[model samples]
Structure formats: C-alpha cells, structure tokens
Target: MDTTKIEKNFKKLTSSNKIFESVLMIGNASGDFNFTREYKRDIDTPMLMASTTKLLTTTCIYALVQEGKLNLKDELSNYLSKEEISGLHVFKGKEYTFELTIEHLLSQTSGLPDFYLTGTKPVFSKVKDRDFSYSFEEELEWIKHMKARFIPGTKRKAYYSDVNFDLLGKIIEAANASTLQEAYEKYIFSPLNLKHTYLANTESDFIPHTYYKDQRLYRPLFIRSCYASGGGVTTARELMIFIKAFWKGELFDKTFFSKQAQSNPLQMSFYPIHYMGGYMKITASYPFGKKYTLVGHSGSTGAFAFYCLEKDLFIVGDVSQIASPSTGVRLAMRTVLAAE
Candidate 1:
C-alpha cells in the first residue's frame, strides 16, 4: 500500500475542476492499502451512488434467487401486471411487454429504451429546470410514453435502460411485500452491518451535493423514485466494504456471482465502464505492462465501487463531477499501478 502515491493521484484528480470533490478508498483482502481520503467533502458524508445502486438492487435480487424466492429467467409479467408496466417496451409493430424476463432486465437485454437518454428527445430535455426531480412512478409514466429500442432478446443487442431496473425495483417490492429500501436493508445492508449505506428516499436526506458542469446541486427528491436503480447513498468506507463483499461472494455464493457477471457486456455512457447484469467492469493495462480487471459498479455522480479480481483489491470513491465520470476509473488504475 502506497499512501503517498495514492494521495498524489487523488490530488491530481481533484485539481481538474471545482465540481470535482472526491473521497477515495482502496483496500485488499489482506487489509493492506486500506485508507479513506476526501476532497471538498467529509470522509463520512453520504453521497449519491447514482447507477451504482443497481449493484445493490441486483444483489438483493440474487439473494432472493439463492433462497428460491425468485428466478432470473422468470417473466416480468409474472410479477407485474400489464397495467403497471403497460406500453413500456412496445417494438416496431408489436408489444413484447410480458415477454420481457428478469434476465433481460438484469442484463440490459430487454431492449427497453432508456427513459433518460434513449428517447428521440431525452427525458432530461423535458426538465425546464436542472433542479427538478422525478418519482419512479412518474418515470414509469414517462417510459410508457416512449417506444422500445428493439425486440427483446435480439442477438448481440442491449440497451442500458434505467426503466429495466425501475421495474426490477417494483419486482423486488412485489416479491417481498415490502418497500425497496427495506428489502435492501434486510438483504444487503443489515447482513453486512453497513450502518451508513441506504437508499435515499428523499432529497432532504443528508446527502452531499454533486457537481453538474459549474452548478453544485443536491440530487432531486424525485430521483429517489429511482432508488432501486441509482438512488443509493454511502460513505467511502462503507462503499468499499460493499464492493469487496459483492465481488468476493459475501452476499451470495460464488457460482451465482459468476452467473451475474457472465452476461455479454454493453459499454456504458462512460469510457472504460462496461455493464453486465447489474455490475460494471473495468479492464485496463497499467503503464508497466500489468493488466487489471475490476468488477462492481459506478455512479454517474462520479461515485465508484469496484474490486480487482486479479489483485484482490477494492477501490471505492467518487470524483463528484458529472462531467468527469471517468475520473474514478482513472484514479483506480493509477492507484493499482502505484501500489505495485
């Protein structure tokens, strides 16, 4: 563990822009190189995990699978009524709504257009003010108004849809007869004793502000509607704990974990960030001819939690810049290289 080198890399990343506050935590199974450092934000402040929330959502889903409560291959209609998810994934000239499966949603293969970015005009464009937020129910209504990207299960095709996980959130709730937040606490946070990690159910929660361009803003209250998809909040220390347990099979068996990562990946809207099932993977070669593969997930608000399988290392933190989503990955790479 090279604290000097890791801090050096963190400093470089924060210097890039005013919006780029950060907290970085890196550790290995041996507890070497384990430290938490923050820039502009306190080390204990809880920040939005953004899309990294999916990692938690998927973990809960898989736990249910392990307990025989759910099956990945189960159809979406099995749990959701047609009215609840109605018109959400209509294709060229046909409706494949019920045909969509849990596996499709988990792997982003459902062909559901991303309600945020995939529309002919993105949903964000509808936001007259950047301060606006939306509820998950409202997001589903908006999704019902959009068209599907393709027929479900088309070979070599996947679209990153927040809708998929939103529906999965609903499924988790339906399956458990409880709220998504409670499900998370029972299945993930509680067992792991993660006192700080939780779904941000409202904008008034004590979450740190994230940077979007030049604006400093707290995530919208409505964004909490997407809690199952990207509405998690956690400190750097807890984020590392979750990611390490996630990849090391602490939440479930290793065979199920492997199944979660075995799907074909789709490039996220960021560099070096790829998605398979509910997790993200980063594959890169450091300058010294060393290649690293790290798996977990990152948030668009520059939050990241990933573990390097080859090195048994965990990197968790945020660059806190919406525009600098790649900063976390860059820091992870540099940190790994420096540790060597």
Candidate 2:
C-alpha cells in the first residue's frame, strides 16, 4: 500500500498544538513497515501503554487456556479466597462476587466498579515525581468500599474495571507460579522477540514522560501494582507486532479467538467506535461516503494499534498526550482514511 497520504496526514497531525510528543507507524500483513517519524522524541522512545496492557494480559490468559492449564469458565473462587472477594458484587441485596469467572473479567462483564474512576471524573493535572504507590491488597480494599454497579454476567451492561484485570494478574501469577512480569517475558515478550516492552515498576528517565493539561503526571503507584492491567510501557513497533499476533491468533487457539470475537454483548465501550475483548472494531465513513472496519486496541494515554483486514493494513503509534487521549484514535482514523 502507498503510504504517501498517510505520511502527509501524520505531518499535519503532529503539527497541531500539544504539550508532549507524538509518534505514528503504519504497516501491512507481512510486517514490512518500520518507518517512523518523531515530533519531539525518538522512534525508540518507550511510553506508558495504559489500558492496552489489557491485551497482553488477556493474550497470556488465552495462551494458558490453549495449553489446557485453565478454562475461561473457571470461577474466581477457585483461585482466590472467599474473604478476599466478599462484598465485591453485592447486587440487589445478593452477593454474587464468587460467581465471577475469568470470562467475565476478560470481557469486562463483571459489573465491578473501576478501582481508578469509581467516583471521580477524569482530570488533567500537573505532576513532578512518582505520586503514590499502593499494593494490590490495598486496591482490593478500595474495591470492597465501592458498590457493584450490577450483577455479574448481566449481558446488557459491561463496566470496564481495572480491578478485574488486577485480579487476572494475580490469577496469571497463580497459574504460572511466577510474577506477572516474568510470566509475560516467558510467554510473550521473549517468544515475540519484543525488545522494548516491560512493566514500569519504578520511575525511569528512559520512559517517555506524559502530560495532562500541560502538567506532567508522576507515574502513578498503581502502574507498578497494576502491571497486568495498565502498567506496561512499550514502543509503537512492539505494539504493532502484538496486534498482528492477536488478530492472527498466533499465541492462542483459533477456536478460543472465535469465542472472544462472538462475546461482545456486554458492551464494554464505544469510544465513538466499538470494542470487545480488549480490541476495538473501527467503523466509519470517509470522504465520498466509503466506510471501513478494522480491529485492534487503543490506550487512554494516546496510544493506538489497529489492523484493517480489507486493506491488509496495520497501524500503531501514540501521541503521548494524556489530556486529549482521544486524539490518538482520531489520528488512526485519519491515517486509515488517507490510505484510501
């Protein structure tokens, strides 16, 4: 595919006003595209991937399932203590916490309140250093304080909860008998040959800094404890490789992938686009009224990766701006449309 128009549109995207850096990359099925341009940072720079880390965690879980080590229908009670999950899903005077399964967590159908945004609206603020740190135990205590939004497996309502993946992180460690970082390295990073992906357990100057409303955020403490959920940091190229593997079902069985694709009823998100099982399905009308649909995922930290099946196109990159996270999705759409 000719990328001249994509490159031109990327130029305009980076030219727009922003407080932090941006990156963009586009490729095809053979994975031949490695071209990159930076606005204020280098192509090698690594940045926080935010919720895109969910894709990694989910992929790892599926790998375990394919190995016959675990099943999606398995209950959380089998892996976690009843006391640990008590009052987690109190719906209509009934506590359905232990009934939650790995499937509910992966599809965001657990009805569990988000540990991060339970009561507060998103705010763009300034930061200087690593702000705070909390253990997974502490996060669970917080979740217990919050009320459940609905019963588990409601089918009509899916609430995106960090706690869901945080629990999954624990499950991964339990199943692998190792830390989430180690498990990822063994099953994913190493096998995929991803050179620049890691969980940011501590503040590092090497990781690209992010800004919200002109004020920098000290990498949150939760980033470390939430490694399987949203603590990962990576580059555009590495993310694209993962996306390609995801769509191609390289690490998991095709039947498992088919199950996930068919289980979008809970409505985890729209983002002005549709998403399921950590993947977004892009659909929109371009100039002259042509429409398209692509599948991939985006991070709230202005990161995006997607594959346009019809065009055999794969695009991945980030704006590295938290204040306008939606900017990354818009840029991806613009780039995809420009290719037409």
Candidate 3:
C-alpha cells in the first residue's frame, strides 16, 4: 500500500490545531506493511488510552469466561452486593438493578447512566477546571442520583456509560478473586509481552497530561479513578500490538466475538458510531461512497484503536486532545481511504 497520502494527511492534521502531540501506527494483519508517523511525540511515548481501555477490560472479561470463572448470563447481583447495586437502575419508577446481567453490561444495554457525563453533576465538565479523585463507591453514589436511559435489555437501544465497564471491572475481580490489574497482567499484558501498557492505579503510575483544547490538564487522580472504564496507558507501538491481538483472538477465543457481533446504534451524540459488545464500531459509507466497516474503539482524549476489516488494516494512534475526541476517528478514516 502506498502510504504517501497517509503520511501527508498525518503531517497536515498534526500541524494544524489543538493537537499538542500525536503518534500513529498503521499495519496489516501480517507483520509486513508497517508504517508509523509522529508529531511532537515519538511512537513509544506513553499516552492515556481513555475509553479505549474498555477493549482491554473486555479482553480480560472474556479470559475469565474462558477460565469458567464467570458467565455472561450471570446477574450483577451475583457478584455485587444488593445494597451496592440496588436502586442503581430505577427507570420509569420500576427497579431494574437486579435484572442487569453481564451480557447487558457488556452490550451497553444496561440502561445505566454515565456518571462521568450524566447527572446534575457530571465529572466531565469539572475535569477541565480542576483535578480530583473519587472512589468507585463515590461514582456509584453519583449514578444513583441520575436516571437510567431505558429499561435493561431494551431492544435496539444502547447507551454509552463508563459505569458499565466499571461494573465489569468489579465483576472480574469478584469472579477471579484478584485485582483488575492482576487479571490484566495475567490475561493480557504479560501474555502479549507488553512492557508499557498498564492500568493506572496510583500517583506513582505516571499518568500523562491530556490537552483539553489549549490548556494541558494533568489529572493523575482522576485517571486512576477511571479504573476499568478508561484508565489505561500505552504507547502507539504497543497499542498496535494489543489491538491486533484483540481482533485476532490472541487474548481470548475469536469465536466468542461472533456472539457479540450484533451492534446497536448509540445515542445521537455518538452519531455514526455503534456499540458492539464492549467496543465501538464504525461503518463508513456516505461521502466516501464505498461502504467499509471499522471495528474497535475511540477515546475522549483523542485516542483510537481500530481495524478496517475490508482493508485488513490495524490503525492505532493518539492525538492527546480532549476537546476534539473525534479527531483520531476522522484521522483513521482518512488513513483508510488513503491506504486504498
């Protein structure tokens, strides 16, 4: 594949706006056909994974399933105490907290409101002004005051909630009898030989500052608090390895993906993006004329890890800009079109 266009677009976009630093790596399923580009940051620079960490959480969950430690059909109450989950999903005056299943959470059909983006007090808006940390229990308390979007397992309806994966992180711990970080090490990072990828757990973990427009915000406490939902750190080079493993069944059985293949359209704010299992799926057809699908996820910090199925291309990168989360997605799409 001629990467002239890819290189040109990368330089053009990185040099233009709020992107403080950026790195990209594009490659085929095979080891050959590799191309990488960087602007103000090297390929090995550690960057926040943001919501793309959901893919890592998803991989670990599947690993537990393979180990017979958990089941998709298991109830949330089976792992979490009733007091902890009760009144968490009361929609239309009916309590649906006990009705939530692992499948529902994994598929983003749990009707849970996002603590980071929803409620009278959303953490997102305050993130730019200041930096602070809250425990998982605090997050649950925040969500309890919020309203659920729909009933659990509502047909064709999906809401993007960070709490879903946050809950999954708890379930993984409950089932495996270990910390989420340990599970990740055993099932993902260690197995993949990834030295730089890690779940940020403490002030010592070295969480990088993300650009929220022109202001650089260093929220180590908040990033560590993200936990399973979006608290991962990795380099562009390592992310490329993990994403390829994720789609190739190296972390878990690829066949399990078929069960979660059916995707549902998310809320309008996430237009042109769909929720499938634990990741985001994008089907590009309009404007470009050719319909092709990209499977994987994008992050609020302008991080992206996706595979263009038709092109057999794995695209991994980070723009490190929180104000324009979709920047990485648009870049990936342009790279896909350029590769052709």
Candidate 4:
C-alpha cells in the first residue's frame, strides 16, 4: 500500500485543527502491513480512551463466561444485592429490575437510563465546570431516580448507558472474586503483552488531558470515577495490539462475535451507529457512496479502536478532542479509504 496519500491527508487534518494532537495506526490481523502516523504525539503517548474502555470490559466478561463463572442468561440479581438493583428499572410503574440479564446489559437493551447523560442532574454537563469523583453506588443512586426508556428485552430497543457497563464491572468482580482492574490485567493486558493499557484507578495513574475545542480538560477524578464504563488509558500502539487480538480471537472465543453482531440501533443522538455486545458498529459510506461495516467502538474523548471487516484491517487512534467524538470515526473512515 502506497502511504503517501495517507500521510498527506493526516498532515492536512492536523494542520487544520491545531488543538488536535493525534495518532493513527493501521495493521492486519497477522501483525503485518503496519502503518502509523502521529501529529504532536507519538505511538507511545498515553491517551484517555473514554467509552472505548467498554470493549476491554466486554473481553473480560467473555473470559469469565468461557471459564464457566458467568452466563449470559444469568439474572442481574444473581450478582447484585436486591437493595442495590431494586427500583432501577421501573417503567410505567412496573418493576422490571429482576428481569434484567447479563445479555441485556451487554447488548444495551436493559432500558436503563444513562447516569452520565440522563437524569435532571447529569454528570456530563457538570464535569465541564468542575472535577469530582463519584462511586458506583452514587451512580446507581442517580439511575434509580431516572425513568427507564423501555422494558428490558423490548424488541428493537437499545439505549446507550454507562450504567450498564458499570454494573457489568461489578458482576465481574462478584463472579471472579477480583478487582475489575486485575481482571483486565489478567485476561487482556497480560495475555496480549499490552504494557501501556490500564484502567485509571488513582491520582497516581497518569491520564492525558483531552480537548473540548480550544480548552484543555484534565479531570482526573472524573476519569477515575468512570471505572469500567470509560476510565481507561492507553497508547496507540498498545490499543492496536489489543483490538487486533479482540477481533482475531486471541483473548476469547471468536464465535461470540457472531452473537454480538446482532446489533440494535441506538438513540437518535447516536444515529448511523448500532450497539452490539458492548461495542459500537457503523456502516460507513466512503467515496461514491459505497458502504462497508466497521466493528468496534469510539470514545467521547475522540478515541477510537475499530476493525474494518470488509477491508480486513484494524484501525486504532485518538483525536484528543472531547467536543467532537465522531472525529475519530471520520478519521478512521478516511484512513481506510485513503489506503486503498
């Protein structure tokens, strides 16, 4: 592949957006055909992954399932106490808390409200003004007062909620008897030899500041509080290795990919994107309006890790801008089209 066009396009993109310190990497499944481009940041620079961290949580959940410690059909009540989950999903005055299952959360069909974006007191808007930490218990408390969108397992229903993955993180701890960070280290980082990928757990953990337009935001407490839903930091190189392994079945059964691929359209805010088993999917239309599927996830902080099934290529990178979450996806699409 002649990379002249790829390099030129990347340079143009960075030049036009001066606040964009970015990295773009492309590789094949077999570890060959590698290409990387950086603007003001190298492949080794760690960046906040935001919601792209959900893919890592999904990997650990699959590992537990393979080990017979978890099952998709298992009820949420199995792992969480009644007091913790009660009143969580009360739609139309019908309590459907116990009706939720591991599959529901993984597929984002639990009808649960998003604590970060929803509710009268949404944390998303407040985070821009101030930095603070909130525990899982606090997040759950916020969800309890919010209204659920639909009933669990409703046909053709899917809502993006950080609370879903946060709950899964708790279930993983209950089933595996280990911390979510430790589980990630064992099932993903250690196995893939990813030295720079980790869940941001403390102030000691270094987290790269992200941009919301021209302003730089460094909310370490907010990032740490996101936990499994979003709190993750990694370099472009390490993220490329992990995403390739995920699609190549190096960590868990690749067969699960088929089941997870039965995606449902998310809310209107996430138009043209679908929710799969803990990941995002977009059928991107390149030049001449030709469409192809890109499987994986993008984060609110302009981070992305995706695999183009039609092209048989893995694309991973970060745009380092919070105001434009879709920038990474557009960049990945352009990179794939440019490589051809």
Candidate 5:
C-alpha cells in the first residue's frame, strides 16, 4: 500500500467535500487486511449514530437469546405486568393487546406507529429547553391504545420507528435484569475494549457536543437517555471496529451471523446495508458487478461510511454532509480493485 497515494486520495476527499467532522478506520477484523487508517481530529468525536443503533439492539437481543434469557417467539406482555401490557379496556377500545411480541420489535413487525407520526414541530421549535426525547413505555402505551392498520408480522416494510428498538431495549433489559446500557456496555463495548463507544443510556460528558440554536438541542455525547437503542452516539473508529469485529466472526457464532445476513425481500435494501443486520449485502448492478456486493451500514446521520469484506479490506473516508456515502462507495470500489 502506497502511503503517499492513500494520503493524497484521503486529502482530496476531505478537502473537497464538506465534512462537518468525522473519524474512521478500515482493516481486517481477523488479521487478514490492514489498509490506510485515518482517525484524525474530531473524527469519531462521539456523534449521534442514528439508525445504526439498531444493529446494536440486534446484538443485545442475540446475546440474550444465546444466554437463554429471552426467546424470539415469546410474547413481550408476559414480562410487563403494568397497565400497558394488560388486555383490559384501557384505551377506550377493545382488548387490543394481541399485536405485541419480541420478534415484532426485532423485525419491525410490531405494527407500531412510525416516529414521524407525531409532528409537534411548530410548538417544539418555540420551546428552548426542549430536549428531543421519546420514552419507551409511553410508546408501548401508545401501541396499546392504537389499533393496528394491518395484522403483525404480515408485511416486512422498513418502517423507521424508534419504538421498535426501544421495545428491544426493554426486552434486553428484562432478559438481563439490567438496563440496556449496562447490558451493551458489559457485553459489547467493554469486551471490544471500545472506549469511544458508549451505550445510548450511559451518561458521558466526553462524547462531544453539537448545537442547533442557543439551546444546544441534545448533548451529542449525552443523548442516549431517550433514543439509546435506535440512534446511539459513537465515533468512526468505534463504528468501524464494531462493524469489522461483528462481520469477521470475532464476536459471535458464525451460524447466527449467517442467519442475520439473510435478506429481507419485503424491504428495499440500501447502501452498506444490502443484506441487513450490521451491514447491507450487494451482489452486482449494471454499474459494478461482483464488486458491488459490498457489505456495510450507513447511518450515524450526516455521516456516510463503507467497509469491504470480501473484495478488499477497506474503509472509506467519512463525511458529515447531507448526501449519503453511496456515491463515494462507488468511487472507492475502483481503487480497491487496482490489483494491489
């Protein structure tokens, strides 16, 4: 690997692009590949990881299953005896309690309302100390009150609901008798020796800060209180490390990983998340054949990333811009296949 060319390419990437701030590293998870690594300033400075947090939730669920503390098929109502889980008439409706389950949350099949439904924006914008928060119990409570548009588990649409991961967070907590943050920290972060990666619920001051107005919307490092399971905060190094480790069979049973890799036909896949789980699997397209089957995930909003597993050990430069990193992923493929 030519350091000069790599550095030149990276410099060109960040210099020309509007990278708000990012940190990234790419290499082999199991000692097979190590390419250019750039973990520069403000990179991985503990920004919000957004939907990539779902992968984290998935890991926690699998761990509980592996430990026999939770079952995918078990009804979630069995654990919570509160008013929300009861089949009684609570929501001015019938016994509307048959639509909830653990797998429903895991597969996004709970028929739960999408997060975008509640738009209090005009009022929310006027408030100063309005921290963006969504409670798990309240969401489930809403589900209890709300009627399903369709039966659960019939369709596999990629409905973006924070409630899905929030429920999984609850399930993880119930299975371990600990907070989702504790379970994630103890099982995943700590084991990986990942300093920059903190569970959403874990409070930390060093996670960096971002601003919206004078109010400072949410502390970039301290936001897990509400959106922990779905949109966790993390850095480039941490994200890359976790992705590589999980993909390389360093963390769990190969069989389970394979199971996770199974594609969801009902949902259209996107860059870096071609298959699902920790990544997307791409086989080929009219543009790039075979090499296009790159596996990875893109989120942690305003940030784009890719990691090549089968073709070349690679990680791309991070950009905290509005555009998704798919464009860059396509360009980088040309470099990875240069017959090094």
Candidate 6:
C-alpha cells in the first residue's frame, strides 16, 4: 500500500469538495505512528456507533459471568423472561412452536424475528394493543412476543437484530439489579476509564443537525436513534485506548481472550470484519500478515469505529467526510478481493 497516496487521499477525503465534515485517525496503541486528517474537527468529538453497542453487551455479560451472576447455558426463562413462557415455544395465535434459549439468543441462533422489523411492528401492524413505544424495556417485551422462526440453535442464517444485544442487556440488568446503562458504566466503561464513550440512554446531549456531503459513504443529518441495542457514541482516542488494552490481554483474562478469538470463525465473517457475539474482527489481507481484530462493531446507520489490536492500532472516524461509517476498509478489501 502506498502510504503517501493514502495520506494524500486522506487529506482529499476531508476536503469540503469531497465531504462536508471529516475525521480520520489511525495509530498504534504504544504511542506510535499517529496520523489524522480531519477538516471537520478534532478526534475527541462524539459520533453514534450504530450497532457497535453489541460489544459492550458482550462485555457486560462477561462481567456477570465473572461475578457468578450468570451461566451462559441457563435457559432464557431461567433468568429474565418476564412473560409467562411455559416452554421454549409460546403459542402465538394458534401455533405452539419450539423454545428459545439464552444460549441461542447470545449466539444469534434463537431463530427469533429481527427486533428492528417486528419491534417496529406498528409500522407494519394495524392492531392497537400490539402497538409499543420505543424503549429499552419495550424492546425486550417485543422479543417476548416473538416465536422462533426455526428450531433454536439450528438455523445459521444471519439476522442482525438489536434484540440480540437487547436480550443480553436485559440479562445484565436482571442479573445486576440495574439498567444496561448503569451496568455498562460500572463494569466496562468506568473501570476502563472510557470517559467519553457511552451507551447512550438518550440523544438529547448529542446528535445535532449538521450538513455534510460525501459521495462514497451514506450518513444522515442530526437525528435520534431508536432504543434497541447498538448505536453507541464515542471518540477515536477513547476507542483506541479500550482496544489496545483489551487486545494486549491486560483488561481481560488470557484464557477468555483466546476463547473470544475462537468466538469468530470464517463463516461469521462479513468481508472487512468478522462477527464475534457482537464485535467485528478485521484481519488485514492486503499487506499479507497485517492481521488485526477490530474489537468494535460497525453501524450501518452512519458510524463505524474500531480498536484494531493486530497493528496495536485504533482507527475511529467518518471516511465519508459526513456522519457515515467509513467505507474505507470495505473499499480496500473489495479492491483486493473482487475480480476484474
């Protein structure tokens, strides 16, 4: 890779002609090789992370496990299923189907319907009682109303649903006697000193109206993200600090870290990144052995941030210049992997 041209393009990408606002930060964990091109502002600004909150959900569950508050194998009903579920299967209308387990839920194998669509059922439903407002608890209730689409733990199809993390979030709170926000603050964000990163309960403080234009990536103007899971907000520097510490086995146990690596396999991969519980792992294939696991997740809703450990690097910013998840990584992968 031509670092010089990439650098030049980095500057061009931040230019107003190609973008309205931009921030790109790339650097190693050990205070090495820090570079940034940002016409928008500094690296400390906050951007919504979209689905990256899944990683936080995983860490929160891990904390519960550490505290002996949860066992992953326990059934969903054993812990947090508030609605009356006699078996794994609940009778909806007239159909009595199979059960949904907590393991299935965590592994994305529950066969539950996507909460984004079903949870937003009012948009598709005419029934009034079925109507539900957007909130953390309501999101969980939405999952309670769903039946497995297939036999739980059997189907492998990818269903990127916020309900997955929402369930995990519920697990954290139910086990800890607190909300997901509090649990996250206590177990993960606070202990690690991630003062800037937050699993937001509201967007009142941030996500203001702004104007930006970048052709390569899509980003929305100031708006609010519905309550579910994912869509967190944070800065690149804070994300990097978290990633570097997590990657080096300093923040978590070594044995668990290795298993965490195993949590992601080739099948779960989505090109530039692979899915592990909720976090996305990206390995650098272009430069041969420049493999890195991007410990954070990317949001389709205009925010992508990562803590890359292979390079001891953490890169957070909008590649599109506006408030959009950077398409740079995918664009790089496509250039190398796609056929002419």
Q: Residue by residue across 1-340, what tens digits does model 6's lDDT show?
A: 2256556656655543645555666666567577665665567877555565666676667667767888767666666544533332343443322255555556665556665535546322321113223555554456666664555555334344566667666667788999777887886688788888776555354542223343332222112233326546677567666655555555445355555424423232244444554465565554564443455555543345566544445565554323333454542332223211
* Residue-by-residue lDDT tens digits, candidate 2, 61-161: 88888777778899998888888878778777888888999888877888888756434422122123235567888777777777788888775567767
Regions of model 4 farther than 4 Å from truth: none
Which candidate has the top score in TM-score? Answer: 3
Off by over 4 Å in 6: 12-19, 82-102, 117-133, 137-149, 155-157, 202-204, 208-228, 260-273, 283-295, 307-310, 319-340
Better of 1 and 4 by TM-score: 4
Better of 4 and 5 by lDDT: 4
Alpha-carbon deviation at 227 in model 5, angstroms: 3.7
After TM-score superposition, the amount by which residue 153's alpha carbon in candidate 5 deviates from its true location, in angstroms, is 1.8
RMSD of 5: 5.2
Candidate 5 runs further than 4 Å off: 1-13, 36-44, 85-97, 116-130, 141-150, 200-204, 210-222, 260-262, 265-288, 303-309, 312-318, 321-340
Clashing residue pairs in candidate 3 (N, C-alpha, C atoms within 3 angstroms): none
Q: After TM-score superposition, what is the CA distance of residue 74 in candidate 1 from its true location, in Å?
A: 0.5
Q: Model 4: how far is 298 from its true place, Å?
A: 0.7
Give the Cα RMSD of candidate 1. 2.4
Cα lDDT of candidate 6 equals 0.54
Which pairs of residues collide in model 1? none
Candidate 4 lDDT, tens digit per residue, 1-340?
Answer: 7888888888887987544699999998877699998888999998999999999999999999999999999999999999888999999999999999999999999999987766787887888778899999988889888999999999888999999999999999999899999999999989988888899998789978988788889999999999989999999999998998899999999898877547899999888789888888888776587777898999988899999998898999998887778888888878777777
Q: Could you say which candidate leads in lDDT?
A: 3
lDDT string for model 1 (144-239, tens) is: 778777888777667788888888898899888899999999988998999988888854566657876777766465456557888788888787
- lDDT tens digits, residue span 1-340, model 3: 7788999999899778778799999999988889999888888899999999999999988888898988899999999999888889999899999999999999899989987766777798999889899999988988888989999998999999999999999999998899999989999999999999999997789898889889988999899999999999999999999999999999898888787657999989888898987888998665858888899999999999999999999999998888889998999888888886
TM-score of each: 0.91, 0.89, 0.98, 0.96, 0.72, 0.72
3 or 5, greater by lDDT: 3
Ranking by TM-score: 3, 4, 1, 2, 5, 6
Worst 10 residues of 3 by lDDT: 283-292
Error of model 3, residue 87, in angstroms: 0.4
- Between prediction 2 and prediction 3, the one with superior TM-score is 3
lDDT of 2 at 149: 83
